[model samples]
Target: MKKTTFILPILVIAVVAALSAVFIVDEREKALVLRFGRVVAVQEQPGLAFKVPLIDEVVTYDDRILSLEVGPLEVTPEDDRRLVVDAFARYRITDLRQFREAVGASGIPGAENRLDKIMRAQTREVLGSVSSNDILSSDRAALMLRIRNGAISEASGFGIEVIDVRLKRTDLPQANLDATFARMRAEREREAADEIARGEEAAQRVRAQADRTEVELVSEAEREAEVIRGEADAERNAIFAEAYGRDPEFFEFYRSLTAYARSMQDGNSSMVLSPDSEFFNYLKSSTGGVSTR
Candidate 1:
């Protein structure tokens, strides 16, 4: 029993030592071996890694891409329009040694904090240089690209590579929303009014043209009727002249009879004339004496 206890303790100690001397790194991670607070070796590949037991430390970092979210930060664009912007960034640690050196004991958290500052600064700088319309437009891919480039350049010192930066949301402040809506409403109202005025102007032009056409038609018809009446009068006078040239006596008798019929149309019609006047010529017979009726 005494020998078994002594050998069992030694075996347990050896197993513990062996377990502490090595570690298994996942494929998604990179391990750094530090001895006495100094980096002694770096394991970028996966699988088993060796280290001195109780004398060395292993730090693992993610080798895949990581994401960082930036603020709903307020920015004033070139047009002096203020906007609230929400953004995010995608980054990866490129050099693990440089990363450790740059971030020191704080590790990923320290690197992220610094990266957040860089992203915020770049976001403000790039967005502020342009107009709010540009930021709110669908073509804002260029602006996002500019922010990413600036962030990548600044973050390089910390062994970070910024893949992309995107603005998730951009909007006017609650205080400005009502004002912008009112302005848009007024603009639409003005445009509607302009369209109505143009329609009325076109209607007036059409109405004036119709009125002119109506007047011209009436005047032309009156002119044509006057021409027809004048032609009729001329033809009747020519017929009268031809009848008078054919027979003077009959024409004179017919004229006298027509005058007598017109004068005696009313039963009470009377005339004052000398009997010897030629007005009684029709009453005289073929002889020189007066004829009884």
Candidate 2:
């Protein structure tokens, strides 16, 4: 019983010692074993690891790529246009030892801060070389490529690998936005005025053409009417000439009777005339002979 009691304490001590030396790491993590607070070895696999009890330490770091949103930065392009640019970056610890040596285990935030500064500087450098129109147009992709490449180049010494850099948004300043809108409105108004002027010119031309057509139509109708009246008068004269040629004496007598009827219609007429006057003779003539009636 005494041996068992002594062995129990030894077992407890051994278990405690074992617990102190044991290190557990996940698949997506890497651990650095430190002796006297100095890095001695790096363990990268998922399993149990060993360390000196009470004298060694283990510091674990995430091995996967981390996302860092660097937030928004105000920038001005070459055209003197100001905008706010929001961006994000994906990075990973390529060299764990260097990462631990350069930035302590609790220094990821500092490294991120440094990376943010570098990215902002590079973004400003690249973007400052382009105009606002280019940034908003077909050169956006090229600008982003240049910025990413520049950031990768600058981040090489910081023990971090820049996997990707992306621009989230680019916003124009409020004052500039109002100016742009006003310019657009003025352009639109000018275009509209030009169109209206063109339309009025077209309408005037159409009206002139219509007036010319109306004048031509009226002149043609007047000429045709005059021709028709002249033809009718000529036809009447020809018929009268034909009738006069058929009977000369009868026509003369009929014209004398028509003149007498018109002159005698006023019953109060008094005329100085001789009995043998031709005008009285025609009136006195009756039947087929000339006689006083």
Candidate 3:
């Protein structure tokens, strides 16, 4: 019984020690063995790894692709236009030793923060070289590629492989949007007013033309009517003069008959005149005759 008790304790202790010395590294992880706060080995592959019991520490990092939201940043282009930029990056830890050396106790969070700085700086540099119009132009694809390349180049110092950098959104600031809208509205209003003024000018020209045409037409009609009336009076006077030359008595008698007819044209007319009045000469004589004065 005593021998069994002694062996059981020894076996239990050995089992505990063996279990602590061995660790399984998963395919999704890269592990580092640290002794007394110093890096001793890096296990980059998935398998069983061994370490000193109670004296060594193992730290694991993800080998899979990691995403980082670089967060929102602001920049001013060459034209002094302000923009709010949101970006993200895809990266993986390429050199775990270098990463651990650079960021000793800070872990992945600290490394990601550092990478964010690199991304922000490079994004600002690439976007700052051109005007804001270029950011929204067809060349924006090339511009974004340059930004990604710049971030990738700068990310190497931090022991990370930057696969790509992408902009989530690029837009004008809220203040700039309000100002731009105001300017657009003002321009539209000015254009509308100009159009109205031009329309009024055209209307005035048409009205003036109509008034002038009416005056010219009225004046021409009056001139033609006056000429026709004067010609009619001349023809009547010539016909009377020719008739008088053919016979003196006959002309006087005919004129008296016309005057008498005109004076008596109304059925209820009354006239007080002497018997020898010239108006009655035509009634007094059946023959064509006039009394001698």
Candidate 4:
């Protein structure tokens, strides 16, 4: 019973020691085993790992790609125009030992700080040489490439791999915004005025054309009507001549009747003519007679 009790206690102690000495490394993590504050082993694969129970410690770091947002950095370009530029970067730690050495106790934060500084410095260096207009231009793609290359080169020293770098936005300074907006408003007003003037000019042309067309149409119709009236009058005169040749007395009577009808056509007509007036001759003698006067 004494032996069994002693062995049971030993087994319990062994189990406790084993539990303390064993650690796990996830697939998403990389671990470092340190002995007396000195790194002794690196475990990069997933599964169970062993370490000295009391004298060793493990530190795990994310072995995946990380993201960083560098800045809304104020930059002055070649044109001496100030702009607010923001940027983002993707980075990964390629060398764990160097990363640990470079950052020490601060870990990811320290590394991020380094990346931000390098990225910002490169951004300034590349963008500062270009005009503000260039930054806003289509050549921005090339400019970003230059900045990214610079950052990648500079960050390599800290065992960091720059996967990509990009400028998020570049904006004018607040002080410049008001002036720009005012200028834009003025330009738009000028363009609108030009458009209005052109429209008015076109409208005038259309009105002039319509007036000319109306005058031409009325003049043509009047000319055609005058021609028709002249032909009808000639025909009527010929008919009267034929009637006169056929019967002189009847023609005289018809002419007298027509003259009398003209003199009395108005509903309220009044005449103060002498009876000898030629106008009254036809009325005075319906049978037709030449006026003696």
Candidate 5:
């Protein structure tokens, strides 16, 4: 019984020791084994891991890609125009040993602080070298790539891999907003005025053309009427000549009668002439002094 008690205690102690030495590393996590604050081993893969229970410490960090947001940082561009910029980054811990050494006990939080600095510096350096227009334009993708490249080089020293960097937003500073809006409004108003002026000029041109067409049409109609009137007068004169040629004496008598009728049409009209005037011939002689055939 004594021997069995001793063996039971030894087995229990061994089991306790084994349980304390073993740990699990999840697929989403990376672990570092530190002995007396010195990194002894790195477990990047998911599986079982072992460590000295009392003397060694295990620190775990997320293995997945991490995200960091930089500031609404103010930067001045080459044009001396200031802009407010917000940016974000994707990164991961590529070397666990170096990361632990670099960050020490601060872990991910410390690494992030340093990473943020690196990103901010690169952002200002790359974006500041270009004009604000370029930073705000679609060409900003190229600038972002430059920032990412710069950050990657700097971050590599601490075992952090910068996957990507992007500008979330770029805007004119609050102080510049009113000025910019005023300038935009002025430009729009100028354009509107130009459009209205052009429309007026075009309307004037159309109206002038219409007026000229009206004058031409009226002038042409008047000329045509005059031509018709002249033709009609010529035709009447020709008819009178033909009648006179047929009978000269009768035509004279008819002309005298026409003149007498016209002169006596108004009761108030009076004309003083010699009694032997030719106008009175029709009144003096019924056949105009020509004997009937």
Candidate 6:
């Protein structure tokens, strides 16, 4: 009776322990319980979980964020610019049953491989329609959104939810880089030449305007000087006419005296005169009142 009691208690305790075994799932983890190599329950909550012991196997998967970097791919844009683009993505396993069925034994590597293929194909298809400048500039965000949407949609079968997609780097081949740089340099030089030519043209226009102004000013000054000179000459002639009209006889005598003085200024000069010449009549009148010595 004592042996039966001990054995029965031991069996009851074992059965209770086996039927009442509980699992503590973390907030960031999902638990998969398999019975006899077949998944029987999926626990996604952050509490205790009961399962049949010895027959149930538990698999814990992280429900946190996961990152996968796709390998570099060569893409040609609409402008014929070839680039090696490296990209990455963030995702999480949203469906454990589907993940287990699709991933099988390969785990995350299998998921990453499948993602890489899809990413490469979608990247090529999306970027191929855009020019290189657009890809490098404003269209990048739209392109990434499209890639994320397409990846999530396609990866739905694999039980993966894509959160975001980002491009890490875009590289140009060495030969293409050299060509692009050369073209850029040529364009800059052409623009510089055009600016220089425009500046020279503007300078020429300014100089021409200045020269025209200078010519106009000089012509105006010359005209003004000629008018003043004419006015001065007319004024002098009017004064002379007024004086001469007032005393014609005295003016004639003064003019004759001025002529005689200018003519006698040369020392070796001879004069011919009549005895009753007007020049001698003045001298005779002065001598009659004074006496010749």
Q: List model 3 lDDT by residue over 1-293, tens digit each.
A: 99999999999999999999999999999999999989999999999999999999999999999999977789889999899889898999999888898888897899899889988898899899989898866557777788878877777776888987778888888888899899999999999999999999999999999999999998899888889888888888888888898777778888877776787786847878999976666677775476464
Q: Give the TM-score of candidate 2.
A: 0.74
Q: What local lDDT score does residue 93 receive in model 3, on the 0 to 100 scale?
A: 94
Decoy 6 TM-score against native: 0.62
* Distance from true location, Cα of 80 in model 6, Å: 2.2
**Candidate closer to the true structure by TM-score (higher is better), 4 or 5:** 4
- Superposed Cα deviation of residue 168, candidate 3 (Å): 2.2
lDDT of each: 0.90, 0.84, 0.88, 0.87, 0.91, 0.85
Sorted on lDDT, highest at the top, how do the candidates line up?
Answer: 5, 1, 3, 4, 6, 2
For residues 27-72, what per-residue lDDT tens digits would candidate 5 score against the true structure? Answer: 9999999899999999998999999988888999999999999988
Backbone clashes (count) for model 4: 0
Give the runs in model 1 whose Cα sits over 4 Å from its true position. 34-41, 54-57, 97-110, 130-146, 167-178, 226-293
Error of 3 at 7 (Å): 1.4
Measured with C-alpha atoms, the lDDT of residue 199 in candidate 3 is 97
Tens digit per residue, CA lDDT, model 1, 108-200: 899999999998898889989999999999889999999999999889998889998889999998789889999999999999999999999
Q: Weakest 10 consecutive residues, lDDT, candidate 3?
A: 284-293
Instruction: State TM-scores per candidate.
Output: 0.65, 0.74, 0.68, 0.74, 0.73, 0.62
In candidate 1 the C-alpha lDDT for residue 91 amounts to 91
Ranking by TM-score: 4, 2, 5, 3, 1, 6
- Collision count of model 1: 0
> RMSD, model 3, all Cα superposed?
6.0
